[model samples]
Target: MSFALYLAIMMTGDQIELVQESFAHVLPAAAGAAHTFYDRLFTLAPETRALFRGDIDDQGRKLFLTLAAVVDALDQLEKVVPVARALAIRHVGYGVEERHYSIVGVALIETLRGALGVRFNPETEAAWTSAYAILSGVMMSAANETASVKHVVAA
Candidate 1:
């Protein structure tokens, strides 16, 4: 199914609204949260750290921007999913594995909780979880399909 359609089926409008609102509130702290997310990701999966060799500050900013874009585009995910898939394809060159997505999600949630403080309530957390799952699932599926095509081309 299309990522947008799948997400509509999997998530309620309330869930999407909660996540978007919570993320907007947390936007000011996005840079710090992004940094925290990367730090936690490195701590959780050290092997993935080497994939980043450039300036971390820029990378963090980019991550936050990308995340914000995704959150903002939840209602029009068809437009965003292609960009996410492109990102997945790029990450393949950076040696990103499928397992890293889950670790990144965990780190992202922890970062949001830390940054948002008491604002990250149960309902908000659930919404964020659903959003992350849908986004990550789309990225991973696209990455896998791209890899398969690459492998076939190589063979």
Candidate 2:
């Protein structure tokens, strides 16, 4: 399944609503959720831990804050594209490869499941999955473009 087709099929008004609503539930425990997300990410991809330099807690906070902003802008996704692109470019500098996105997505879903518990139903999971897919897709595309440009310049 191509990313474009997946986005077209999975990202709908109802799914957006589900993601927004489910994320609202995560806000109260956002700190914990962030911690869980990082923990899961490191566990899933231990090598990726080399990408972080400073405090894990601080990084987690930034993660949640970014996520909050992204969730708030879901209805206007275009508004976040530039920000995501810049972030992605920076991530490329941090040794983040394209495959790390999938590892991060799995960690995100697990974090949501742990945070939402019973509230994280199949529909909610699907919503968050779609949202992550869309966001990561944009980031990965931007990263790839940046890498290509750098390669061309280097060559």
Candidate 3:
């Protein structure tokens, strides 16, 4: 879908602006927030911890960089959805399930709130929620499609 069409269907301009502004405030402290996010994620869903076979620090950096790309592309979701879908398919190989997305989203918002302190308001929270939902939904759908293809090929 086109940018305008996609935006109308899900996230609004105001929500995008809120997400951009809130994330910008926390970007400088992203490393710490990344750590916090993973900590929270692991705590919330311990079973998901095994998926991180690599260094936590390295994984955190990649996560933040990917998040930055997603945030930056909020105005042009068409540009970000493909990347999100690709990442989702890759995640399936890492043993990441669709349910993990919600845990990560909560952890992410909590990380931002902790990192940003007073800057993380209700509006910002709502925006991030909407943004993450859109991104995760695309990724989950792609992952499911990939799984279906694999099953068909195997059969």
Candidate 4:
């Protein structure tokens, strides 16, 4: 399926509320959540480990901060799209591939489940799934566009 199709399937208002509310609970333990997320990501896609050259803790913190910002701007996604696009382009430079987004999404859902425990119900999971789908769709689309430009220039 095309990224545009993924983009068309947006989260419902209730789903957005669920994600934001659950994420609020995550903020207090953001450091630990970040660590768990990386652990899950690395375990699921060990090859992804090679992409990070910096301290894991530092990278985790940065990832958490970015997630926080994205969650905060969920209702106004336009505000986040430019940032997400630039980040996606940068990830392309860092050897990130399209498949990695699903890996990260799986890791994210698992991390949230671990962090939220009993609170991470099916509804909440569905909400996050929807949110990630849209966000990753936007990112992958941006990355593809960047790659296309690069290919054209090279050709």
Q: How accurate is candidate 3 locally (lDDT)?
A: 0.87
Show pairs that collide, candidate 1.
none
Candidate 2: residue pairs that collide: none
Per-residue alpha-carbon lDDT of model 4 for 1-155, expressed as tens digits? 64343454487778889999999999899989999999999999999999999999899888988888888887777777788998999999999999999999999999999999999999999999988987888899899999999999999
TM-score, structure 4 vs. true: 0.93
Show model 2 residue runs off by greater than 4 Å: 1-10
Q: Tell me the tens digit of each residue's lDDT in model 2 across 11-99.
A: 78898889899999999998888888888999999998999999988998899889989888777766767778889999999999999
Residue 141, model 3: lDDT of 88
* TM-score per candidate, chains pooled: 0.95, 0.93, 0.93, 0.93
Candidate 3 wrongly placed segments (more than 4 Å) = 1-4
Give the higher-TM-score candidate: 2 or 3: 3
**lDDT, candidate 1, 24-142, per-residue tens:** 88788777777888889999999988999899999998998898899888888887788898999999989999999999999989998988889899998999999899889999998
Worst 10 residues of 2 by lDDT: 1-10
Model 3: per-residue Cα lDDT at residue 24? 87
lDDT of each: 0.89, 0.88, 0.87, 0.89
Residue 148 C-alpha lDDT in model 4: 98
**What lDDT, from 0 to 1, does candidate 2 have?**
0.88
- Residue-pair clashes per candidate: 0, 0, 0, 0
